[model samples]
Target chain A: MHRFANPARFLRIAKPLTPALFWLGLLLTLIACIWGLFFTPTERLMGDTVKILFVHVPSAWLGMGGWTGIAIASIVQLVWRHPLAGVAARAIAVPGATFAAICLITGSIWGRPTWGTWWVWDGRLTSMLVLFFLYLGYIALSNASSEKGDTSRVAAVFGVIGAVNIPIINRSVVWWESQHQKASITLGGSSIDTAYLVPLFIAVVGFSLLFGALVLMRMRTALAEMRIEARMRRMAQG
Target chain B: MPHAPFIIASFAVTGVFMTWLIVSSYLSMRRAEASADALREQS
Candidate 1:
């Protein structure tokens, strides 16, 4: 982790890695999309509505996963003073928020047909909504603190604090009565049939790769901006 | 095929946001890279 603290070294590795992840992820996602949409049979109960799961589940995982990345990066920033920690955390905010919003919107879209409404104030839904708002606030705070170069303590603190919502989001459906379904894929075993589960799993991996690529891209950009600022500062000083 | 609208809408919105995030981030990277390069030449 500390090895990547040097922006030049990070850029060297990321330049090649970014497009690799992006293109591969896009290809896999397209494959999964077609497989899920055209080839599979609809669920007996939900019918075509279950098709939304391809996008919905992936978005949900990444929405939560993105924040997890933020919190981890924030921890690194606070603890080791890792130079790229703040950059990585900031890079995560927009994409993370985008996924969170996607989850909410897609879930709402799924809900309208299956559950007879667009949304509910159940624990799972409400906490996921909070996670989304937390992402928004993190973005705003981190953006305001960008000029600091390597440190954004306030936003880092917020990132860590916001992580409290993740567990709440995960456990909400189980803990409280809600229209949201409980975890079909738990460590014990998956309730999802093999036909849908395969592509769904692929979709998750592909989307995760896309998320990683986006983070790398944004981190590279942040590094570049930092370079520009540093150059300008040195020029003025000289 | 009954809930086609919801299914299509879900994927469509997901695609839209994914595209937007990618393009916007790429553009910013390009712009920042260009500026940094220009400054390097000046220095």
Candidate 2:
């Protein structure tokens, strides 16, 4: 971890890996989406609306997973003072927020026909909304700190603290009886049918890879910006 | 198949947003790399 803390070393590996991950992720996601949309059997209850699960579930998972990345990166930045940790955290914010927003929108779209309403104040829904807002706040705070030329420690602290909502979002459906369905896929065993599970898993893996690729790309950009800033400072002093 | 519209909408939204993000990130990286190169040439 510490060895890769050097930006140049990180770039050496990331340069080749980024396009590979991006293309692979794109291929897999396309296959999964096609399979989920046309090949998979519709649910008896929800009919074709169940197809929404492929996108919704993955978005929700990545939405939470994004913040987890931020929290872990925050820990690395705060404790180990890893330079790339802050970069990793900042890189994740926009995509994470986008995933969170997608989750909310798709979930709402799915809910409209099933629940007879476009919105719900259910536990899962509400907590996930909060998680989205947390991502927005982190993005704003991180940007502000960077603009002001302050250490990202404040944003890192916020990243770590904001993680408290993750668990709440995960357990919300279980803890409270809500309009949202309880966890269909869990450690105990998945209640979902095998047909649905296969495409869903593929979608999740593809999206996760895409998420990783996006973060790496953003981190590379951030690193480049950092180098430019340092050069400008040196030129100014000289 | 009655809920086809909803399914299509969900996928459309995800597709559009994900594409935008990927393209935007790639372009930003390209711009940053170009600027960095210019700076290196100047120095």
Candidate 3:
């Protein structure tokens, strides 16, 4: 695992994997979209509006997942000082921020019809909004720092501190009397019926793959930029 | 459901946002790769 810590080796491995991931993500997203839009039955209560869950839920999952990735990478970069961890942290931020934003927007869209408002000051919603801002802060801090090492350290601290909100975000439904719904998939209970579950699961997998592909692609871009910067700096110094 | 307009609005808004995200990311990555190629050419 650590052997691939070298960016060069990681790129060599990821280059071929990129095409495969791209196709897989594309195919799955297409299938999920078709299944979700047409195949899934409309909820008798929410009716066609319920279809928003297909996109909204998966994006919410990925939003949390991306932050988890950043937190782990940040920890690794700070504690272990893994060669590529900082780059991984930075690469993950772009997609994480995008996913977080999507989750918020989609949730707001879903809320307007169901909750009677497009925006809410609910605990869960507010925490998720904070998560999105945290991602932006990490990106901005990383970009603003002059030294690579300093940037990584600053961003790492933010990543770890921001992570305290994830559990708070997750548990906001239970902690506060809120309009947001509880877990659809619980340890011993699933709120969703079997009919809705299938397509929902498909969408979740599809969205996960899409997130993975985007993160990997962005990482590759960041790696390329770093290489170019390093070469230019070396030339100037020489 | 009872609200067709709201449903359409939701889908349209979400779809447009997702489309923009995918396109912008692709363009950004493309530009970065182009710059990398240009810098490599210089070196």
Question: Scoring each candidate complex against the real one, what DockQ results?
Answer: 0.80, 0.77, 0.49
DockQ of 1: 0.80
Residue A4, model 2: Cα distance from true site in angstroms:
0.8
Deviation in Å, model 3, residue A77 alpha carbon: 0.6
Interface RMSD of 3: 2.3
lDDT of 1 by residue, A26-141 (tens): 99899999999998898999998888999999999999999999999999999999989888998999999999999999999999988999999999899999999999898878
By summed lDDT, the worst window of 10 consecutive residues in model 2 chain A runs over A143-152
Per-residue lDDT tens digits for candidate 3, residues A115-204, read 889898988899999999998898999889667777779889999999999999999999998889877787797889877788788778
TM-score of chain B, per candidate?
Answer: 0.92, 0.88, 0.85
- Each candidate's interface RMSD (Å, one decimal) is 1.4, 1.4, 2.3
The whole-model lDDT of each prediction reads 0.92, 0.93, 0.80
Q: Candidate 2 versus the native: TM-score? A: 0.97
Return the TM-score for each candidate structure.
0.97, 0.97, 0.91
Select the stronger candidate by DockQ from 2 and 3. Answer: 2
Ranking by lDDT: 2, 1, 3
